[model samples]
Target: MKPTEEDNKIINNRRDFIKTTAIAAAAFMIVPRHVLGRGFVAPSDRLSIAGIGVGGKGKSDIAMFAKSGRADISFLCDVDTRRAAESVKAFPKAKYYKDWREMLDKEHKNFDAVSVSTPDHNHAVQCLGAMQLGKHVFVQKPMAHDIYEARIMTQAAEKYKVVTQMGNQGASNDGTRILKEWYEAGLIGDVHTVHAWTDRPVWPQGISWSINKANVPNELDWDLWLGTAPYKEYVNKLVPFNWRGWWDYGTGALGDMGCHLLEAPFSVLNLKYAKDVQCSVGSVYVDEFQRGYFPESCPPSSHVTLTFPKTEKTNGDIAVHWMDGGIQPVRPAELGDKEIFGDGGSGTLFTGTKGKMMCDTYGLNPRLIPLSKNENLNVTQKYKRVIDGADGHYKQWVDACIAGYGKQELSSPFEIAGPLTEALLIANLAIRGYDLKIDELGEDVYPGRSAKLLWDNDSMRITNFDEVNQFVKREYREGWKSITL
Candidate 1:
């Protein structure tokens, strides 16, 4: 896709700003070292971050960046004042705004980077808007709400020449590197099947939207909160949380936990976009005789299977099973009956030609099945460990932003996070497809439930099932902009 006229203007403005900043830096560099005060850091050496969604996880994200001591929280934006109260108090000097568009419009020149921890639906637009202004971005995962958005965000990161990091902090964990080393060492041979399960939905799902509308909270800007999503009347208790169960604003269990659970497999197996997907979801009944049909809400539970083309590390195709809503795969026979499966709550299991291995969420506590194998296992540490593992994830991005694009390696840059997120969203297509209804001879039938969806990654579409294609790239609310290349 070609850049729009507005895009060209933004690009040109960013280039001019860079040129001006470079000249200023050059002049400053010529000053004598003796003239400067002791312990003075150059303005260019520190990263100024503008945070969007500065509350809840957003609040913590910015806090971690501030903790790096290299990042200055210069601006904060959140639609809900109540949710943002803690962050606002924490960063008293940071400029605050309810609308992110206004913050970026007026203050883009002041910040060196942007941190986005908004709802899944708003991630792509916020991140892209920052990148267009030549600002590096650290966005929460899944990187985008839909597959198409993920692709665009990944491409935009490179096109704009900005450092990017997805908020899958687990990517920086030592466990991921350990798994990669073990896989490369042929300890588990060739992994052919993988199962990742999560006990999620901890929020409501498989339900209908409330019929009664509630008064909008005094502290929240409802419209801004719904950016990129269709406008809806205010519903009780939907702000601080609960949006995860709805399709319009969240990507359900996959968006919430898939990145954390799947990052290790992606890193170890060199997995990219999925080739095909199929799924079976648990159903809810409205009554004893009738099943509930609430398409807007994600199912209570789902087991999705995604197939990937063979990679260099794999002998053939690979099947990845994703289970959510407390459903889990059968425990491997290698595991003793008394042994806990996947940290008890949620975990990932890898089945290989030679053996099986497993890890808890965030890829922690990885071990070969039978427990005994891990005792004597010794694999050379090939990948350098992050300074503080998961805790370092925020600092890694902060440091990289200060170092400039392409100067440092990130654990979950858009190139990696995009494809990983896309694969997860594609699996969601099957889950959503399961509920698609078609009228045949006046009787409703779900053809999508029985068909395996074929994916054409290049086109970002489901080749066989057209109904689900609507979700590949969702339509934003009338005034909200859609992501463009």
Candidate 2:
């Protein structure tokens, strides 16, 4: 139809408007990746992490996440500026804060997840706070200060539906998988006894807390550093490291290496909370005449025996022995006179019905006893290995966070780590119980040393010894929040 110039112009404008509107509607129908599910981030998107304790192990942890090339270290927090200097210098673009509470409060929206590498006592509080905010967490080993805290952290992860990973990097190692495959294939049949030992406490133990308070360093926030622990004056050699020996701040030698050493048994045998535990600790002497009793510090050494109920992988109960502070199990008879047992300093040995196998720390260098049995021996790999093995731990967490909760499997998720941690803490209950004192006839008597502590996993307490239950759930200092699910 031949139309006037104005009519033709109006028709052309209407056609252009309809085409634009249809394009807009199509774009709207294409949902954003985030709307797909909780924590569902697009592949191209980078994860923004707020590190709560960015020093030492914390520093290396966040750096590993950055190495994944999928994460952005957006915020850094530490109680000590001197300790944090290297991290700040490495991640200059990241905003820095001294108090983790302030950082989480003000910048929660800016980050997608939180990495907690603080001291043992503070792990639970910081982790729970982040989970309450719907933030994923990657906490350092042991996960919590107490058994109660570990249980709460485990439940909180489920309740909040947030992804969680404990920093037991060895759980990702191929050695663990190899051991598992060997056991499942009946190469090592029905492991009934496990011995895990370490030469730890390279730091001080069985010592008295310094009475001479040192002036707080200018670069450190002493009060903040004592978070969740009882108020104590700043003492020399406590910061940066040594807190591990003191009961108030650290979990002692067992806490330091149990996760690394005992992880193999837990993974291979599916060992959970211990039903009972007993221990004998080495004592320090102030002089030849008198034995030193420093209840405030972990003993110089100890031998702990924990009994776990049978699992599908086991024929009956299992007895797991833990030794630290340079103690080790008796050398296997099959081992040659000169052959090193457990990498010289630390190792784990599994004594099964058919044969025995051993590995060094972090489940590395696994081999059968008699050592000759390792020759020409091959077991089909039943489990897929994590790329790059143990070193890939950090990237694994980053990938899981991007994939959302319940979408991917983690080597040391809280479900697994919580029980492993509780077992270690349970062993600690016996160690601490060994030092428990009661006054009788005007003289102190140690009854805990004589009893084998019975544990009730549901109640999270020692049924036989009430005093040790005090350690199961400690009292947080006034004004600091306690962990709750």
Candidate 3:
């Protein structure tokens, strides 16, 4: 059955076209398949995973996920295609998608897990959507943009029967465990007030809100980028990095740095809830004519005082004071006077009725006050666990994941972590609203201040302030509903 020369040429051309077309289709659809692996590794199954947002902190998250040789990452989603493309160098065989909604719809059920490293506003929606489809989730710190969203996430994670982890990587640190143990042992003796601080002098610290509204870029889908936040025009300062200080995109200095700074104290003291929170702000950082660094919508520098009610519920009542942006606390002059009192880097100072202990946030190293040769004041106990010198926190997560889905303990479970986050977030809320006051108890405690921000947990809406309250949970732009447990 030898073919004629003309027939042979025609067949060859047709075959080449089919081959090229198949390759192109795989390039598009293979994101999930490539990222999730055709079949998960047996018994000790390899997790099929995808990454959303691969720039800035997202890039570091990608690297962390990569460390887990047990997982296969085939799909990389990023609004900035350039950033997404750069990520492919690590997993060349993986696929890429610019829009997560498209990927989720077209490639649903492909992945066993998802890494959500998007902005604060986008975290809940994306994480909820992923978990809705029976997928495991690993989200970045400060789990949600607001208290209500954090509560929703907590409930959803429980309902889904899926594994969830927050990005408070420090929670897994052996030092944190040791601190918790120390508290149980009553080493610090009923820590009454905790002073947490940070020297986060990152770029545009005070100048974050000075963005000049401009036309959206061709590369950025500014509409989609806005996500749940109200439709607003693109501004130069709003994008990339400085969004951390803005009320719409972020929770200001406290939300920006509080999760990390307050971890040690929250962990050691088990600060559950605050009975009352009173905040006062110093002079706004402004020009001669009182031109604030940010718009009138934002807070310049604030000092907040949170008082936890006394109860027979384990430990005694405690007070936590948060100081940021060069606004130090008005406390025991002994601390204000000493240079050590105002060390002010990212850390926590535990002022007990007896002595004080200060620990640098992530470094896990603490020292008792009076730098003089006082050997008796040293914290004799040390963390004997391996987390002290482990390969970055991500490895701990992977090791836990490998031990089988639900068997491992999370570094920060929603039960304890959620409330601590609320305490810090409340500080951000108070900073933005003037004359804000929450009384000893009652839903309408902060009267004459801002309108009551009550949550319709069912709808994820704040009853007051129609304009901004809608931000609680954003309407996903088509094919992007949240993943409910």
Ten residues in a row with the worst lDDT in model 1?
32-41
Q: State the lDDT of candidate 3 residue by residue for 235-259, as single tens digits.
A: 7746677667665667667766777
TM-score of every candidate:
0.92, 0.93, 0.76
Q: Write the per-residue lDDT of candidate 2 for residues 1-485, one digit (tens) a residue.
A: 89999999999999999999998997666768667877654545678999989999999999999988789999999999999999999999999999999999999999999999989999999999999999999999889989999999999999999899999899999999899988998987889999999889888889888664799999999889999999988888788888999999899988889999888889998888789999999988899899987989999999999999999999999999999888888999999999999899999999999999999999999888889999999888889888977779999999999889999999999999999999999999999999998999999888889678999988888888898899999999999978777
**TM-score of candidate 3 against the unseen true structure:** 0.76
Best of the two (2, 3) by TM-score: 2
For each of the candidates, give the backbone clash count. Answer: 0, 0, 5
Model 2 / residue 451 / CA error / Å: 1.4
Pairs that collide, model 2: none
Stretches of candidate 1 above 4 Å error?
Answer: 1-41
lDDT of each: 0.92, 0.91, 0.65
TM-score, predicted candidate 2 vs. hidden true structure:
0.93
Q: Arrange candidates by lDDT, highest first: which order?
A: 1, 2, 3
**Candidate 1 on 163-199: residue-level lDDT in tens?**
9999999999999899899889998889999999999
